[model samples]
Target: MRANSAAAVLLLLACSAAATAEAGGGPAVAAMFVFGDSLVDAGNNNGLVTLAKADYSPYGVDFPSGATGRFCNGGTVADHLGELLGLPLIPPYNGRFSVGSSPFCGVNYASAGSGILGDSGKLFGALFPMERQIQNFQRTVEEMRARMGESTEEFLSRSLFLICAGSNDYINNYLLPLSDKPKAYSGAAYAKLLVRRFGIQLESLYWSGGRRFLIAGLGPLGCMPSQIGAGNSSGCVDATNRLAQLFNANLRSILRRLNDSLRDARFLYWDTYSTSSDVINNFSLYGFRYPHLACCGVGRERGKFACPPLLPLECGNRSEFIFWDPFHPTDAFNAIAARRAFDGRLQRRSPMNVRELVQLPLRHQ
Candidate 1:
């Protein structure tokens, strides 16, 4: 179901594209680079020690290879995106860049529980910091260019970088009672600070010749099963969701501004929020039955020590579930959402979908 080789992925995409073309399907993309938290994370957290791991038993139960450290029993949006782009599933950003080490096609910098602000925490215990992740990117680029020389840009330009973060900030750190309350960033103020930091980090890529960016905005945290489990009877957390909206709002403005200023740098905001909601709103169409309860759980989704551990009730069919855990999605749900993103059905895509962000030629106008 998931292909790890870029060439394999390309083959799948090509086959899928040909099938779609014959049967009247949608537009196909080029490449994909997944970055962010557990949402888009493939197995990037495998190298890091994060409490957000789904590598334990029952986590990857649905996965073909069993536990692979992916939050899902299987692949995430990154895997689906690679298939969508017609390339092999990219490898993690750390370690030696080898087919055995890293897939050598795309790089996944996402560490489980890593926040956009490079949050300090005990969960992941010094997981790859956002700044450090960027450094890894720069190092990778230098290394790639060293290997590929001029052909590097030709290869990279067609790729799509998918970034999904800031969830841990809202759900794990700032929300937890045991968390150290940082007065520096709270609510909208915190969102702004994150936005600013993101811009600075992104500038590093822009100046370094990276162009397109598929900036995946935060999904509605309040609507997540975890948020509901966190004690909100409305089935959705307004305050938490508000924080996500606040982040997305700033991101939209910031990206447009960046694109305007840079002229050629295409920074597109992938509306993970809206696209994710399509599933919540219409689950049956997507083959999901329980949109609320996670496939693997410690009973009815609320209470403590329920996740990544033994649960009273485990769904027989994870494919019928929308949420895999309180935070992560099932492989089926991830597949639907990712395909939607690829199809540009999120209403956030422009003349070019979020995938085309990297394809835009960048020049500081």
Candidate 2:
């Protein structure tokens, strides 16, 4: 999309969302910039050619307005992140919505099944690389500026950058071994690759004027519904979870080093692994009826498909449910996750918390 056209569209969407939030007696989110996979995907893949697309049935069934391409029934972590930041949830940078019904705070550039690398095979004959997502973010900002003018600064600076990705590289790409090594990079190699690629891609944002960032680490890829279903048809695979730990560990180190190297970069880590694990570890505590079993979808594990597609029972209340589908979290899960992430509990990992990381005022680019 042309930069101006994209901006105009965002301006309209933002205004619409703002109107709705005001009516609801809720405060509008300052602004938002998102990058990730299905976990935070609002609707980027809807336009792109990919089986990972969620525009179809049951994906947005739980959304406030119903069926918004959020991958799950309702909202996503990105939307909840905006709420935590004291703003309204945003939608896809590409998805269309009415003025009165939009992710008001900002737009989502996340794509389902997209990875940190374009190596997730061709989506619609084209790859949705992290670089492309970042570029889209820049375009989003440009669109906002055209509409709000000076208000754009506050929205951009105060806005949060929700970046979630890496699972695809491990799950869809290289986690599996083969004769020709077909599909994806090796697990260990993909970790380093993600770190490096993440650094480069995020640097583009930093230099382009983004300051505060909320980057999510890789979740338990092996433990995902698809992975666990690989052969076991059960929830929570030990080896896959271990690989998650490896990725998370490397991610922890990378975040620290990136902060050190960037000096002024005020970035925060959204440890989806821990946050995700917290749910699995304490499902009963969270009011989950089935922690190991997916609330929606088909098969024991490997046969799992979209939730709405299945004729199985639906949880009475999703807020207390754990896994929404085979590979994603439910809307209620995101609501709580936003609370945890904003409360500073979920993002608390090794070296220091996100608050401590962004402590140094960004003085230089």
Candidate 3:
């Protein structure tokens, strides 16, 4: 079952005192600002003219509002995190925030198909690249300062900034034969390019007052049903998985460097790859029966396309499936992952878990 609001509140409140003490006596997590791609996107892609969207039926069949552009079958990692933080679901920065939005709980700047590089998602369509997302965040900070007259820096320092990107850089750019990226750059070169850009982005955020960061690493893209279907193989694609590992290694190094340089900042790396692969390899252990196929979609592996509308070909037992669509995890999996991030001691999330991250005493540089 999902972690409800009350459960999340209870969980966080129990540690709130400790967190307050740790942060040199400051407020508990004030807000959670999210950035990156679709894995954490709430509904940022709803109005976008991109093919990478999930604002339709069977996408949110289990959610209360239904199809809020979330790629998952229900709430996303952001939603689960919000509930854990005792805050309402984080709103997308595009639609609602475009017209005088509030950053009370937080704002989600993640857009489906976005990448670390501006041109990464260009081949797919007009998606919000990481640059644009950061621009939006700057706009948000300005707006908050103008309206609330509050100390934006202080507020942001206590907030949690979550980042989850890099998948599309490989999935849509480096791996797509039609794209010229691969021809222009080798896999190793591409990874370096992405990491350099990512560093700039994070550095920009730090300059903008962001201090608490939870950066999620790339997941096992090779194991996605789409890749599995494309290869017609019984297992995941090794080549693509290697790309993810390379990027993850660089990311860990980046975090270490950022932590060392930005003395006041706390950067925690969430190992999405390891956590997800665990579920994929041990589906039955995680109460999932189908790890290789999506509950929605149709084809040799039921992953050639997105889930159709009106529930056609949709699985009734969505909870039993690890993947909801061709390329996204179901709400069940997202919940499990989110909860683990909140308190799990697994090696996937290190230095300190999300719970410890929230309670960390504020440090000013």
Candidate 4:
């Protein structure tokens, strides 16, 4: 099918599912727990002393909340998925809502500039690594245990765990000039190391009560505007793209292993790489005019730096652009990817799509 036609069909299905969920029927899963880096961060960086914050004008101009610290112009992929699942916006872990409330829907633990490795984005300062995010979720689980008692496990088993990370491990650490990671490990070795640690992180969450998992593979990092600008090249940086491919391949193997070994748990992988590549390669088909340039930055490809605060250089036709800033996607692109992740075929989402994963019957524990 044509890319645009497929996107339209997905959009219709998403709207129909949303309507079904809203017509007095509850969301598909109990809740959605988000983890990972900036790609899906809802606003955790706002409370942190990090350079990766987006709580200002033009950042969330297209979003309903208007600059709630999302890296995108509108909603993140996680936000769109939540809406499609008939759930309200998943609150960030740092937000006030996470403290007093039971978060029946779920909380987002993703932080901008964080990665599987603790020191991956230390250059940015004060963001939650995957380990810390899991620790925070563990605390939330404990709180839920206090409130729901014996039912906590069942509630968690029914919840969806959405993890979208690992990009920073490459962009902010391994690939960076000053970082020692490149010197310590080869590209293949680095990818293996990341997947190994990620497996450990997933196991931690599993022990903490998570059952259903939706882990997003890294997108085409080398094709981001920032990479293009950094390389001063007309196209994507091939070496960086190769690194992402390696990591994604390792991640797929790890997830299959996890699903095979972990009883009652299902770990599904979402191919962000293929989805983003499709949008980039077929930009016109997806109605995107500028797939390589950011909608909100300055410099070559408008990606030399993060989108500045209180600036008017941002693109007026945001929907026509793919990248929102140097490293993130515009809301339009995010919606496409989210829809694909939710209901795309097995080629895009291995094992099963999120819609199917959410509907899987929970075996009696």
- Please, what are the lDDT tens digits per residue for candidate 1 over residues 107-220? 677777777666644466757656766776666566555555774564455556677777787777777777765465678887888888888877776765566777788887
Model 4 RMSD in Å is 8.1
Which ranges of candidate 2 are over 4 A from the true structure? Answer: 3-5, 8-29, 101-104, 121-127, 142-155, 176-186, 233-235, 301-303, 308-320, 346-365
lDDT tens per residue, model 3, 203-306: 99998879989899999999999899888588899999999998998988888899889867888888889999999999999999998888888775788887
TM-score of 1: 0.82
Assess every candidate by TM-score: 0.82, 0.82, 0.89, 0.90
Please provide, for model 4 over 1-365, each residue's C-alpha lDDT reduced to its tens digit, 9 standing for 90 to 100.
12322232232233333444543444247778899998899898898898888888888888876989899899999999998987778777786552222223677889999999999899998999999999888777766665467756766776789999899999999988888888899999999999999999999999999999999998899999999988768998888999999999999999889888888888988889999999899999999999798998888898898788857855888999999888999999989998998888744443468888887765543
Query: Model 3, 8: alpha-carbon shift in Å?
Result: 24
Overall local distance difference test of candidate 1:
0.66
- Model 2, 1-365: lDDT tens digits are 66434654556455544644553543233466678777887777777656776676666767767666677777887777666555555656665644444345566777777777676644335446677887776776676666667756534554456788777766665654542233445657656777887787877887765667777877766556666665654557777787777777777787777777884565777787887787777878887766655666787742266665445446556666567777887887887777776666544353144333333334542
Which residue window of length 10 is worst by lDDT in model 2? Answer: 351-360
Highest lDDT: give the candidate number: 4
Candidate 4 wrongly placed segments (more than 4 Å): 1-28, 98-104, 347-351, 363-365
Worst 10 residues of 4 by lDDT: 1-10
| Global lDDT of each candidate | 0.66, 0.65, 0.79, 0.83
